[model samples]
Target: MSIEIPGYRSGTWVLDPAHSEVTFSVRHMMISKVRGTFGVKEATLIAPENPLEAKVEAKVDVSSIDTKDEGRDAHLRSADFFDVENHPVMTFTSTGTRVQNGDFLVDGDLTIRGITKPVTFEFDFGGFGKDPQGNYKAGASATAVIDREEFGLTWNAALETGGVLVGKEVTIGLDLQGALQV
Candidate 1:
């Protein structure tokens, strides 16, 4: 006996930012975790037959970062961090993908403040289904560790208690939904 499996087809999928989010959390002086999210961003995935062959790209507007604190958010967009005026956009382009035990590891180049570095995220496939309006949708989530200093976000202060402010490792999370076009 022989068996066959259905494969993904060629199409351009648009990310539903309204339902998707790019969020992060970083330790503050090894004490508390500071969490924030980027609001204005978009991503596209082109998966043709094989998810590994997909081309993924994402663009995030620096000024759209929000931590729910006006003062901190403003400062983050200033010269110390994202520097929204000079580098308004941060982007990511996938280099390749690997699947293991029903999960994916996507390796990509992330560009921030004119600096480009490779990063890989462990992705969870959220199953494929069609919406009520007949739109095909697929969901995925990924997480990765990043160094803020690598992106030139080195601004910090020494805490009166003991340690220096901010942490070296930043955790990034992505919850994405893509609309497949056949």
Candidate 2:
């Protein structure tokens, strides 16, 4: 079976930052998870008649990384992690879409800190509707796991017990809402 979004229309959709978010989490201290969110600078969706033919491009503000802790946030902006100074924005450009065993997948190139890698995100359609302001809206969510080391984010500390300070694998989640361009 193929994926379908009822009431879907072909057009350009601009991301509503107020209604969208990009979040991530990674193992911390070898025992717990550290979660954070990055501000979405901009994103666009070019929807085609067939959902599988749709295209998406997004830009995230790396300097806007927040984990609720100022110190850690600062460190993340430094050369160790995101290195926001050198690369202020991370981008994703969709390459194609496909279905696997009834699941929707979006294949894209994710660029972080100057490193670009191919990644596949499992996507879920949240349907379309008219918002309270009388604007056409579309919603969707996607998730993917990536290795930080592959993106040049290799900073870590050796734990006294046996593991490392931070986990290498990072899970990224996107809850996106967009307004159809008139």
Candidate 3:
């Protein structure tokens, strides 16, 4: 199932931390939204000769979660949420890729707080570019939605207005810029 990633030559690539990010957002107080980013620890993307068979493995530091408030960040790193001391990292590994509606769909397993579940990311290949230093680069974006409770992140408060303090569903977005290493 070979599908072309436009402008990208088939090979392995490494995500450039300076240009890549993974962020997530969740509804807060049933009205507003809170967003945070998890720092990328490392990643390797194997763009196979048959691109559809590509594989990507990544780890994100849960302890690096930041929402601008140190208090909240501490709570997220505590036992109530991510429990970064026990589970310091969240990980993703793609199982396969398929095209639908002219877009690439990556089926993968997302693990958080020791819970592993199958999820899909809407993948977009951003083609190729050359850095000033002459290094070839390829970019892509991926987005997915998941249930926080499913991953054991169920802490919340009930509002007198009738809704919970935090929504159960979370949206995760990944913008990756990979430098071709081979």
Pairs of residues at least 3 apart in sequence or in different chains that clash in candidate 2: none
lDDT of the candidates, in the order given: 0.85, 0.94, 0.91
Cα deviation of 59 in candidate 1 (Å)?
0.4
Ten residues in sequence with the least summed lDDT for candidate 3: 1-10
Which 10 residues in a row give candidate 2 its minimum summed lDDT?
1-10
Best by lDDT: 2
lDDT of 3: 0.91
Displacement of residue 86 (Cα, Å) in model 1 is 0.6
Candidate 1 lDDT, 1-182, residue by residue in tens: 11112434468999988889899999978889999999637888887666577789999878989898999999999998889999999999999887767556889999989899999999876767889998888877899999989988899898899888899899999988888876
Model 1 RMSD in Å is 3.0
The TM-score that candidate 1 achieves is: 0.92
TM-scores, all candidates, are 0.92, 0.97, 0.97
Off by over 4 Å in 2: 1-3
Q: What is the clash tally of candidate 3? A: 0
CA deviation > 4 Å runs, candidate 3? none
- lDDT preference between candidates 2 and 3, better one: 2
User: Cα deviation of 90 in candidate 2 (Å)?
Assistant: 0.2
Cα lDDT tens digits, model 2, 1-182, are 24567788889999999999999999999799999999999999898888788898999999999999999999999998998989999999999999998788999999999999999999888999998889999899999999999999999999889899999999999999999999
